[model samples]
Target: MLGLNKTDSKFLLIVILLTLFTPFLMQPFAADSGLDQFNGGYPDLMQKVAIFGIFAVGFNILFGLTGYLSFGHAAFLGMGSYAAVWMFKLLTMNVIPAILLSMIVSGLLAVIIGYISLRRSGIYFSILTLAFAQMCYKMAYSVLTPITNGETGLQLSLSDPRILDGATESTSLPVTNIFGLAMNSSYKLEALNRVFTFNVGFYFCAVIAIIAFYIAIRLFRSPFGMMLRAVKSNQTRMNYMGLNTKPYTLAAFVISGMYAGLAGGLLAAMDPLAGADRMLWTASGEVVIMTILGGAGTLMGPVLGAGVIKYLENIFSKINESVLHSWFHWLPDGLEEVVVWVFARFTGEGWHLTLGLTFMLVVTFLPGGLVEGIKRLKKLTKRGGKPKDKLDAPDPEHTPTPSKHVV
Candidate 1:
């Protein structure tokens, strides 16, 4: 886990804040002014943020706990998504079945995969899994075209027979009316013509994110988690101590795969579409990036890393000089021009460049990642907070000691 330095503590606090109040934070009137630009609401993006957070959290369970880098975790995620979509087509539109089926399918897949891959460790295991994932991907894209819908992706077809709880074929549920709140509304400041959208999809994601965070926290504190960490630090040592590291490692792998599946299911449940592209090797790498960027071993780091990545993707890419011009209308033209240009360079098509640079800088300077950087900053601040004073300070014996006698 990222060292429990003050900065890391703040990182935990930030995750808690974001996940807990995500709905309000996404609203226009909330503390963050960036919300006003969205007229349709941020719920759609929020759903994605939550799903990815779930994905990263699950990945951390493997790499963070056992230090095993399979590099094919996305296979489970993709499989889960397909399973979820199938569930939607066959059963009711309710997410419970989709999520459950996703986990079960992923669990089975992981069992077979881990059994084979775990025979070897390190790069060999990673390559073995990668080969397997690629094999699966090709099958889904071609031979299994009928099942995967050939690359156009799977969708909810009313034509399909939902044999289980038929949820009125005519009515596909609206984007999660969780508490029945109208999620598609927008708040407008008429005079300024500013609008803040409230997307229903975002709330659905936020709630799920909160639940995922809680689960991660519990995992970090559990005895199983301790054993997993031991396996990572030194598997031989654990084995020498009579602990069967194999069982622990295998369990962690399966658990992590299940997590990836859950994330995938959520993605499909939020929007009834499952694509084979999600199983690509690049997608697996993305999860690794998320885990590392946030601080691999820390519970909250993965979520933070995921949010940061998604934010850059959705919020950062959408940014341009013109958007900046609108945002900085309150500033003078020359100053606005400079600010807009500088800010725009960090976004748009080259957003990946900015993320890569930021990631590199953090890794180089902090090594421990963003969580570590915060810790260093907090230590410095704490040191600075103390008022000037020398140790012993002469004990005040040489002066001012006579003042207390009168009182």
Candidate 2:
């Protein structure tokens, strides 16, 4: 189905089901429940999960397949955001043009960056990309202030000429929309003592994310993907075999960058703003962490990693000292204080500490990331059942004879 084998088709179906039910799944806690604060069904965070999922998936295409780590993808992401915002400002509030422009602009930038960066391999390549990203970030903050709006960031203004959208008499800034459907429009469902929000923007992003995942799966199984794997396994060997790996690598890099751009455009579509912070080195590092934590080179790993990180950022970071005290109030005063102090360092403003610890553990124990951990657990479970009877096992007498090798 959809050019995918049975396993991949089933996987894609699972992803679609999960995405379709995201609003319900994310809002597992009822509104009146104590765990309600942990629910991440809000449109904003859901949009982010879908957006960054696209970002991490794209990064995985390059790094996971080609083993070329880029530390500058955030530059493309920012560029996409800037382009989308400009599209909104100069063209229309419609998201189609904004998304299209974002991908094109980012793809062009990726071509130039990839051409230069692909000249080197490994750490040198990573550093070159990082330098380019930092350069772009500085340019946006300084010389390109006219276009980027400097440190204040680029945002929609009332006076701008939205050529395609036509002039409006409204005093407020126009909201981003698809035709007449506002991106922020949402419907709330109240049932079973729970409230679930279905947002237009999140579904839009989710659809795009699903498409991206499908593309990634197809690419992973294609001959081109095989060539990429060859490059990662040994570029020198491929080159010695009369293959020019540069074009393939460059293509992968650009595709990956375009994916980042699409994610950036989605962000702007959700909220019409672009900032230099999006292009920061740390922002680039975050995607790297997401990809690695989810398992590089695996189809669903990046998305899983993105969801986990975003969930931690939104839900776990909300755990404050007061919240901790409330949860631990039953304990002795001294012990509660001690517990809060220890727990505080891993939540709230220190959520990164938790992330850091998780990344360290995953890299140390499950080097293949969360996907590997899951796979191992599955294997363990399968082995945990009652031992197979000797008669139930494959019989050597009935097995086919081994083919003799001619020497």
Candidate 3:
């Protein structure tokens, strides 16, 4: 760890507090209110939050550090998912090989794509990546049937041959296991007079998410990370300094692609299916949204953003007529019908519109994302903290003082 004084200590304390408190902040959404008409539980959604957190973290390395916006990153993610599913089909359901194969395949794909895409920079680079991704999607949906399984999505079936010896000839995809420790999809819980059940997969994802966070933190502090930051701040200057920035940028791209691959592999581990939808442009855009929404260039911000978006996608869209009836029927006959009519439009297909509006508002008001907004609110209201001890304060010893107190 970098040596730090009292100011840095306070900043670290705040971060620790936020991390410890975030689950509590998110606890209300996790509960089975009438809102949880479907599969609404902290454990289940937390898995999604973690997996996509891996995804957005990967994207941040490229877009955040290298300042290279990629529109094809999801293609790598899809390839990884497909690879992971195929591993499950042909080998053991243990996630180790699945995850490794997924990462390797995605890295190889990134090498090819990044080589071509890196030829151009700025908007042209982004367009090149986009075009490549669209090509991948098209091939998956059409000519790549043997590999990708096309439209209906690639599914794990026992009919497929397994070359791996000692592997189970499974009718169902092998249950998630390590060595011999089986990971089931169901866990029991009792709360008040109610009973609850959830999946072990959720906890697996949570553990992985913490690992992902630790990796991102290490990357943010490494010298390589600082060089990547320099590239973002001034590419021409870095070039003039005789640094071959291309290799660094390409490495970042591949690394990020692999992170996306890990995320996709995790998804496949949970579901044992791969879909062309994983390669969609919207999927790529989701990472960008996640990074910016959570706070671009800030550790843990993208995870927060991914959780917010996914929570909305799943829970925010489940309000149907029955859900409406259960809610406002107690009001009165006339008011209930009218209220349902109005609210129903905002659910189902209308969820995207609602999200779009939320995106617009967030971007317009908090361009630095929710993290920045929270920072501002803290500064404005929390007068208890000293300004000199603020997290973003410049290092005092490093700062040029008029006095010759070099010691």
On TM-score, the candidate that comes out on top is 2
- Model 2: lowest-lDDT 10 consecutive positions: 383-392
Residues 1-407 of candidate 2: C-alpha lDDT, one tens digit per residue: 98899999999999999999999999888887778889998998999999999999999999999999999999999999999999999999999899999999999999999999999999999999999999999999999999999999999999999998899999999999998899999999989898788999999999999999999999999999999999999977998999999999999999999999999999999999999999999999999999999999998899999999999999889999999999899999999999999999999999999999999999999999999999877766777753354437778879877889979
Summarize candidate 1's per-residue lDDT along 1-407 as a digit string, tens digits: 34345754575667767665665555544334665444223666667778899999988988887889989998999999999889878766667777889999998999999988988889998999898788778878999989889689988775666676544546644332233343344343323333334455565566666666666766776889999888888888987999988888888889889989999888887777898898999999889888888888888778778878887787667776677787889988789888878777787776888999888887788777777766666766777854233433557766666665665
TM-score, every prediction: 0.79, 0.94, 0.84
| Poorest 10 consecutive residues by lDDT, candidate 3 | 21-30
Task: Estimate, for each residue in 1-407, the C-alpha lDDT of model 3 and write its tens digit.
Answer: 33434654465456445444333434443345553344445555656777898899889888888889998889988999999988877877787788889999999999999989998899999999999999999999999998888998989775655456355555554565645555555656655433454556766666676666667777877899999999889988998999988899999999999999989998888778899999999899888888888888887678778878888888768776787788887888988899988887777667777777778888999988878878877886786656446566777878776787678
How many angstroms is residue 278 displaced in model 2 relative to the true structure, after the best TM-score fit?
A: 0.4
- 1 versus 3: better TM-score goes to: 3
| Candidate 1 global CA lDDT score | 0.77
* lDDT ranking of the models: 2, 3, 1
Off by over 4 Å in 3: 1-43, 163-173, 193-198, 330-338, 384-407
What is the Cα-based TM-score of model 2?
A: 0.94
Ranking by TM-score: 2, 3, 1
In model 1, state the lDDT of residue 307. 77
lDDT of each: 0.77, 0.95, 0.79
User: What TM-score does prediction 3 earn?
Assistant: 0.84
